[model samples]
Structures are given as C-alpha cells and as structure tokens.
Target: MTTPMNNKNSLLVELFVEELPPKALKKLGDAFANEIFGTLRKLDYLEAASAKTTFASPRRLGVHITHVREVCPDIAVRTRLLPLQVAFGPDGEPSPSLLKRLEKEGATLAQTTRAFEQDKEFVFLEKVAAGRSLRDGLEAALHVAIENLPIPKVMSYQLESGCELPGWSSVSFVRPAHGLVALHGDTVVPIEALGLQAGRETHGHRFEAAVDPVVLRDANSYALQLQDEGAVIASFEARRAEIARQLAAAAVKVGGGSVPIHDDALLDEVTALVERPNVLVCSFEREFLEVPQECLILTMKANQKYFPLLDAQARLTNKFLVVSNISPDDASAVIEGNERVVRPRLADAKFFFDQDRRKSLASRVESLGKVVYHNKLGTQGERVQRVMHIARGIAEKLGDAKVAAQATQAAQLAKADLVTDMVGEFPELQGTMGRYYALHDGLDAAVADAIEDHYKPRFAGDELPRNNVGLVVALADKLETLVGMFGIGNLPTGDRDPFALRRHALGVIRMLIEKDLALGLDALLQDAAAQFSAIAGFDSSKATVELRDFILDRLAGSLREQGASAQEVDAVLAPFPQRLGEVPKLLAAVRAFAALPAAAALAAANKRIGNILKKAPEADAHVSELLLKEPAEKALHAAMAEVVPAANAQFDAGDYTASLQTLAALREPVDAFFDGVMVNAEQADLRLNRLGLLMSLHAAMNRVAQLERLAV
Candidate 1:
C-alpha cells in the first residue's frame, strides 16, 4: 500500500544484503546517506528543515529522513529565444524565428515578452512547470546514491530464478542484495533496486533473532523494531558505544586493574562485524606473555580481532576481550572455543621468536644481499653499505669519534632484520625485532636502541630517536633515501608519493630543528649526494640543487603550520640559513622586529634601498667618507658606524632578537637619507658612493632577516 499523494511525512529506506567489508563500512554508509539526501534536496523534494539519520550493521545499510514531501510545489521557469529585433519585424509582427520558437515552446504571441539580459533585449517565454512527485524523485535518488557509493570492490551475481524479470539474469553490487525497504510513514513506497523488491521485511542476527524476517511498523519505528524482535543494534555509532561500555565493564569484572588495549581501528572493525555485540572475557596461556607485547598485541588485534588486556603498569596480561555476535546463557563453550583457537597462533609467534634468536643479527647480514631493495639501485646489502657511509660522514661533521663509530655500527645492522624469521612473518616488526637480536648479541645498549629508533617518527607527531647515535643514523637513513630517489627523478606528484620523499624531507627538518644539530643543510645534501656516484644514471649535481629547494619549501610550510606567518617564514628562509637549528630564533627575531614602531618605516626604506641597489649593480658595501658630502648621507653613515658593529656583535652571539632590535636605532637616519638625498647623482663617484652607503645600511638592517618582507 502507498501513502496518500501530496502529503509530507518522514521517510525510511534500507538495503539488506550480505555482510559488508568492515574496514569500508563506515565510508560506504556515509556516502550512501549523503548522496540520497543531496539528490532529494536538489530535486526540491524535501522540506526546509529535513534531517537524516544513518544506520549500518553487518547485514544492512539504511537512512531515516524527516520532513520529506510526497510532491514538490510548482515553480516558474524562463526560456530565452531570439533577440527582440530579430524576433519581430518592422511592422511589429512575429517573424519566422519567432514563429519557429513559439511553435517549439507551444506558446503564442501573447505568451512572449521582451526581457533585458546580458546588456541586450531578448524574447523570452515564461511558464509554470509542475514539480516532481515523490515516487519519481525517490527512484532517481536511489539510483544516483547506489551508483556513487564508494565500494572497494564489486561483484556480479545472478538474480533468483523466476523472482525478477525474465531477461534480468544478473546484477552487480558491492554485495548481493536480498531485500529493500522504502517506507513513507506506515505505508510502503514501492521501489526496486539490485533485483530486489521494496518491502518492510529485514532479517537480523542469524541465530538470536526472536522472529524471522522482522516486519517494521513505521518509518520511525525501524530501529526499535529491529532491536526488540530482530535482536540487532542497527545504528553503527550506538552499537560501537555499547561495545565500548561492555568492554570497560568486562575489564572491571576481571579486577587486577586490567583494561582492554585501546585501538580505535580494531574497535571500529569489531563494531562492523557484529549485529548485536557481546563482550566476552577470554584467556590464553601465560607463557606466551614472555614474547614481546607488541607482537602478541598485533597478532591478536590484526588476526583474531581480540583486545588484549593491559595491567596497571600497561603490561600485557593473559586475559583478553572478544566481541562476539551471539550471547548464550552458557558462554563457557564459546569462551573455550576462542581460547583453543588462539593457542596455536600464540605458539607460532613463540616459535618464531625462539628460532630467530639462535642466529645473531650479524649472521643475517649476508641474507640481505639476496633481497632486492630497488632494481634501479641495488640489493639490500648495497643499500646498507651506502647508509653506513652516509652515517659516518654525518657523525664526523659533529666531530665525535665514538658517536661516529656507533652510528656506522647501527646503520650496518639496521636492515639485517629484514631477512629474519620474525620480521618475515610480520614485516612491521623489522626494526623492533632487530633491537632484541642486537641486545642478545651483546652489542652496546646505545647501538641496540639505535636499531629500533632509526625508524622513529614513522608518522606525523611520532617521537624522534632517543640518543645522539640514533639521531645521526635516523638522519643518515632518511637522507640516503631522499637523495637516491631524487637522483633517479622519482618524485612525488600531487597525492601520489610512492617514494615518501616529502616525509623523509620533513623528518630531516624536524631532527635538525628539534635536536638543534649544528649541521649545514647544504653540506648534508652534498655528502649524501657524494655517496651515489657509483650509480650510472644518478645525477648528483642536479638532484642536490633540486632536493635543497624541495626541503626548503617543506620547511616553509612546516613553519606556517606551527603558527609562523607566511611573510615571516619567507624572510627567515630567504637567505637559506645553513644552520637550520637557528631558524626558530631567526623567526622570533623577525616577529619582534615587526612589532617596533620604527619597523614599518625601516622596512619600507629597506625596500626602497633594494630597488635602488638593483639599478646600480656594481655598488659595493664600501662607503668613502670623503664622498659623503650630503648632510643626510653623512648622518646615515655616522649612525651605521655606531649601530652596525653592535648589531653584528649581537648577531655573532646568536642573540637574534637583540640584533634586530639594535638595528631599530637606524630608522630615523635611514628615512631621512631616503627622503633628502638624490641617490642618482650626475657625478660617477657621487652616485656610486651613495649607492654603496645604502648597500651598507641594507646589509646591517637585514642581518637577522630580510626586513623588506615585513613591509605591508
């Protein structure tokens, strides 16, 4: 039965199908609901305050919308024709053009009028067009919504025999659709999609549903009916919250300050895998806890979708929480089944750990030679050799023999774990497992930590390496990758960064700035580029220049993200400061200098001086006192004599803010000189002398930053 025509009411639409991919469920749900709402609103089939609610589960995707209209109101539409003069003759009678247009529009001369548009008069036809009906609008909206869904993959399946149209043998969708429901109030608004007919029937939990094919009562009662009879929590967010509450309560029941390990992605996946969540406490053998907690936690979370509990000190405990879809009075059978299933998985991890320890990391180094790093480059062994040399070069720049040796050792052993049994089983454990093996080999604590810390800052906001040796190796590793990739002309374009060069550049910047390392940016690039000379196609000279520009651009963006204004960043980075550690101080000085009352005048005068110096390209910073005949030029020279030395001393002392502030004293003389002196004098020496005077003042004023960039 259908609702009465032209009535406004809340509407509901649902698609019941096979289980969806848990990782992509949320995205699919959002895309479906938003596309439907947008299409309805575009067609003027919604009330002003119409709102939508989304529901998704393992076997269903649905949306409930309020204040939908059965029929949209009529609106006025205009159709343009030929120009006024062309449409009518000199006698004011309709011409052939007007006749043809009127015939096509089904209009008469009385229905046509002259309107002004685009600075010209045109003949236009005005008509009232009836709005679309709900059935027509909704059918179109459904097709659009389904077509635009962000399905990770699609599958084709044959419709049921004798159920659909005779020729409709197959259909394609993210999953096979079994039923669809389109409700307007208590009445079903008939629609068809994916070889399924619209109805109020939707199935719930496979085993716990109180009724088969639960029938919804109305558009507003779908969620309640599903929960009361179907034993399903239909809304994704509500179900996730419920699971969280149950997980927390289950932890409390276990005592010993145990809490389920927190991973939002795992929580989301668990929420999508169950229609009705039942958090059950399960346990495994305690001997497996001897393995690294990361390995165990990863195995459980990634493979079993189980939450391993952590004690008060955040150590993994044997007790874990599992979110099951069914809740029987006797949960012991289910608990035991899960426990028995996880035992072998844990044993595999234990076996791998025990076997991997038999051979020291140094012995595994030879195996890396057989594993290819990049075809254009060389094997993993060759890459490791490059990284060791680069690390040594960087450490030597710091002038510490002990740190240099430590960095080389760490770099040499970093990639050896790539061939280990544990790392081969779980690639994410490559660096982590290396640290364990290094320690077991009786290596230094610093070297062991560096093996793991070299991959620190794997993502944004991640921590940096812990020790100086780690820092040196991390920088060297990132630099080697960056220089090698850029040399091959393999660069990131738009959103596609297969090489992750941008990340490597940012990592280098963060370490240099955060650690305040006294390293020159150009020299680092040069040294890195120097290691790639053996490769045939590698262009060291060109890649080094391009890579430098790339890194500086990234630094400018980073500084802006950290709250520095664009202009301030430009001023500080303009000179391309070699010691990147001093960038923060330079920016601070620029900001401080910008706040002074004399700052505006000084910046403006500096800009004017730059323009004048550009005209006299041969001007040097040597001002002859004898040629300083004008009072303004002499006063400026005298002021610089007193202030330049003091500013230079402050700049040399690394007191950047004080250095810029000291230059503030020259603003008056600078402004007076620009206003009173004619820099382009007729005599050659006079003009050259004046230009040299301005050049000296410009040099002194811009010691901390390019002050002209602060000009408004």
Candidate 2:
C-alpha cells in the first residue's frame, strides 16, 4: 500500500481459499479481472490513470487497483417535459397546481421553451450532478462484481445460516473468501458492509513461510515484500525465465545431455501450479524404455504433470523433469516418489501392448461392430463400410486402383483399435495404437501408416495426411461424419459444436489444398449421402446439399484466413466448381485477377450489361447477325469475338490476371455500343437481336465471376 503523493483513489481485493484446480484458477483469474473492469465502466466510475492487476495461486486469488480517481466526474443531465400548452393554460401561463408539482419533483429552472412540430412546445430542464467519493462507488461496485465472478460450482459456509442465499450466491467458489484488503494510498478504507476488513497483511508460500504474513506498508512495498521474504515471483514473465534457467541447468546435469523440453502446455500448467518453482530431474528404469515411447511420455505428462525429456536424436529419454512448488531439503526423496508412481502406469501399458498383440489385426475388425459411432449413424463397422465405398470412389478418380484397395482395407481396421484396452484407457492414442498393432501383426507398412495418418489433423494447426492412401481415408472419415450428422439433423449452432464438425470440414479442406490432391468433394459427399440414405432410410439428396453447404462455409472461412478479401472469395466461388482442391486454385486466380487494373473496369462493364438485360423483354432476345445494323454493335461484337479465345486460353493456364486483362479490352467497345445504340428499337427483330448480344456479353463476364456478386 503505497502512499499517494497527490490525493488519488484505489482498490484492493483478496480472496483466500482452499487449494484450487489449476485449470479453474486461470479461468477465474481472467473472469475476475474482466468483471471488475466491466462493472466500473458500467457505473461510470472509471477515471484517468487507472490500473488493475490480478494474482492467483492454489490457495488465493487477489486483485489490486491503483491511481483510480477519488471522485467520479460531474455529469450533465437533462429532463424532457411535455408540451407547455398541455401543462399550462391556453394563455401561456403555467397552472398553479402544475407549478407546485414541478417544484416538488426538484425540476430545475427551464432553460428554454421551443415550438416543436404540430404546434406543440417542449420545456427542457438541465442540471449538473456532484461527484461521489471513490470509497462510496467502490463499495457498491465490489458487491456487484463479487456476485458476478462466474463460479459455476459454489458452496456456502456458516455465514448465511438459516438465511437462504440468493440463487446467484448459493453456489460456493472453489475457495471461500477469508477477507479483503482495500487501500487508498497509505490509508486503509473501511469496507465492513460486505463481510470484509481492509488489511495491510498478506501471506506468502504456505510451505516456506506459513503464518508469516508480511505487513504491506504501501503498494510498492507489498510487491517487494512478497519477492524478498515470501519467495513469490508475482510477475509471470519473471517466473517463466527462472523456470527456463532451472530446467536448462537440470537438463545439463543429467549425463544423457540436454533435451529440448517441448512442453508449452506443461510450462503453462507448471507456472500456474506453483508460485516458487523448483525444477528437478528424475529418472526411471531403463527397462521401462522398452515400452512404447509415446505411452510412457503421455502417462508421465497426463497423470503426473511431468515434462518428458528427449535425447540428441529426439528420442524419449528414461528421465523427466518435475516442477514443484517448494524447494525440498532432500530432493532425492521427491524424485524417488515420482519414479515409483510412474512405474506402475508404464507397466500397465506394456502389459496391454503385449496382450493386444496375441490377436491378429484382421480379427479385431469384428469388434468395431460393437462400437457406436453415433446413435443414428449405426455402428463403427457400418461407417467403415461407407468409408470403404468412398475411398474406392476417390481412388478410382485418382486412377490408383492399388492404393484404393489399400485405403479400403485401412479404413476397415482404423476404428478397430478403439476396442483395445490401451486405447480405451488413453483415447488420444486411438489411431496411433491401431497403427502399432497393425505393424506388429505384419500388415503392410503403407496400410499401417494410413491407419495413423488418416486422423492427422485432429484440430486446427495440426498436421495433414502425408500419403495418398492416408489422404483418401482422411477425406472419407470426415465426409461420413459430416454427412451422417447433417442427415440426422445434428448440425452445429453458434458456440455449440457437439461433434466438432467444423474441425473435420477444415481438415478435409487443408488435406486437399495443402497436399494439392485433386478430389471432388461434391462427388464424394454425394456418394456418402447415398450410402447413408440407403442404410438409414432417408432422402440422400437433401443431406448431400446440406453437407456441401456446411463444407462451403468452412472453405470460405479458410480462404478468409489466408487473407482473401470477402468480395474476392465470392468472385472466385461464383464460377468455380465445388471441388475441394479446385478452391485453392480459384482463390489464387481471384487474387491475381483483383490486382489487375482492368478487373475493375471489366466488373463495371458486366454490371452495366446485366442491368440492361434485366429490363429487356424475355421474348425475341435471340441474337441474329442478319438483324444487326449499327456499326458500334458490330464493332463491339468483333472485339468480343477476338478476346474470347485469349480469355479462355488464359483461364485454362490458370492465369486469371491475364484473362481479366483480355476481358477488359472489350470494355471500350461495350461503352461505345451502349452510347450509340438503342437496344429497344421499334423493329422487334432488331431489339431482340440487340438484347441477345448483351446476353452474350453477360455470359462472357460470368466465365470469370458473377461480377455483381464481387461488388465490394
């Protein structure tokens, strides 16, 4: 609690609680910061030079505010009065009773009376409200903010006994609030109304200095005290730097050499798990290394929250690093305990791996029938059959019969490992486990890799399929899930994606574009819809359309993410066929075309032609060269004829920018024809022929894009 050199206001709130879950701690810290600031803004109490800071540990959540205004700014308020004619007599004199009521209501002297519409008059009343003290505003705001802290699960202590807490407060937070500290410079602000007392004392790490509370004389001193006596590094950046230095030193000491500890998630978790981190290296049995490296590492990380180490070759080492909250007197004992806990888990994994190998990979395919994919979509076995059909179609289109057969076989066994004991225990290892089992059973290497790589991009920013077989199976898997869900009407709504269909759709798009694999999504989806319809008894066409639209939405989002403008995307999609791989090329063309100076003029010319055709009568609109009379029309037709071949050639070579340039050459001729010609001539034959010429221009423009749709 630092003393204010000048008169300034501030707030401090601290919540003491039992141990909080690490995951919930970060969420609560963010929620409290946002809620407090929002409440202050809503009440118009936010003033110049305000700062808010939040700190959280397993046992406590605290927030501090500094340089807040001592009082809110004075605000001007206005009140509108009904027409004076209605309140007063026709002679324009106020009624005696009305004047008395206005005075009683605290109405200020009228600033002016002005004539409004319809012979009505309005009177205005204005006043300036005096500011309130910071303490008064914060006291009211604290009550509202505490109630709004978004603690989904809460409990109540004995404080509200016999009195029903409001539904909002009935829930108790992960930790109960012990007390609050409110400070205005060096002065302690009294806040007894909300069961809190302003205090100058705060605690440090429970293990190192339990009950040794430091009296915070000022805001600056409070921060310094925690650092010196409490051994608490309040800043996240300082803590991270210290952890990295300790980890590097520990890794160097372990003779196996320093391994890149690639654990950003673990780093974040460990940072939140402790205020003062003690990084130590611990080793396990070398015999346990024989177990699958992934299983060992995942078990250590997932169960014990340890960071796995890798050797120079990027192989998993037998050692791990654990970040603890307290520096131990005997560090070796902690290492021994962690090693003991990890051994049993690794032993279980090794056992499951050996037991699963006794059966052939082919035999496990039967177990998929018992695994439900979705309630309405039948079993995993049935979905595999659908994937097999889709994969075969994709393979045939790619002209790779051998790869298609291999993909079909891989899809059949992909989900079979879901029934394995190891995968049941660790859901993240579904495809990885399957690939390992297939290889152990002497399946083809390609088939085994396909099993694993088909699920490559499980989420955004994840890897995509590396082989054609994997690519086909990946497409099939995503298509089935999307089509089946849409058929059953389980589409994702705003903020509610139960099935993660969006990820699947985006994964499919990335596989096609990034890998440059040419596959027609519309055709594949159509086939999938048909298969689902036949098995489930519904109209497949509607499902095909819905699924296509869903995928298109994802494609649009992906394109936008790549920096394509909204209008450019619409321009490309307008003429491009709905093929997964073609979208990337179309987008490229649109981007290139948009950069050309001619593109704007071409778009304007097309829009003019379209507008003219909209007004022309549908009857007698066929182009007949014999009916043409005007030289401007004849010249425009010749110019279009000359550019058509060049435009088509440029488009075929994927040079859309060149094609747009060729199209723009017609713009001048088009303008001249419109300037000199009357499209709706008295001669019906001439009018029809002229209209047909305009229609031809519209069609040519549409070959590149529906320019009207590309309007920015």
TM-score of each: 0.95, 0.90
1-712: candidate 1 lDDT, tens digit per residue: 1222233398889999899999999888888889889999999988897888888898888988888998888989888889999999999989998998899888888887788999999998888889877878888899999999999999999998877854677998999888899988888888778877788888978999999989988888888888989999988889999999999999999999999999999999999999999999999999999988888988899889999999999999999999999999999999999999899889999999999899999998888899998887889898899999999999999999999999999999999889887888899997899998899999999999999999877888999999999999999999999999899888889999987889989999999999999999999999988888999899886568889999999999999999999999989988878999999999999999899999999888888888888888889987899999989989989999999999999999999999999999998988888779999999999999998888888888887889888888
Write one digit per residue (lDDT tens) for candidate 2, span 46-121.
Answer: 6656667666666666666666666778878666555676567878777675576568667644643444556666
In candidate 1 the C-alpha lDDT for residue 537 amounts to: 96
Off by over 4 Å in 1: 1-8, 93-111, 165-169
Deviating ranges (above 4 Å) for candidate 2: 1-10, 41-47, 77-127, 160-171, 192-194, 234-241, 595-597, 611-622, 680-684
Name the best candidate (by lDDT): 1
Give the Å shift of residue 637 in candidate 1: 1.6
lDDT of each: 0.90, 0.74
Which candidate wins on TM-score?
Answer: 1
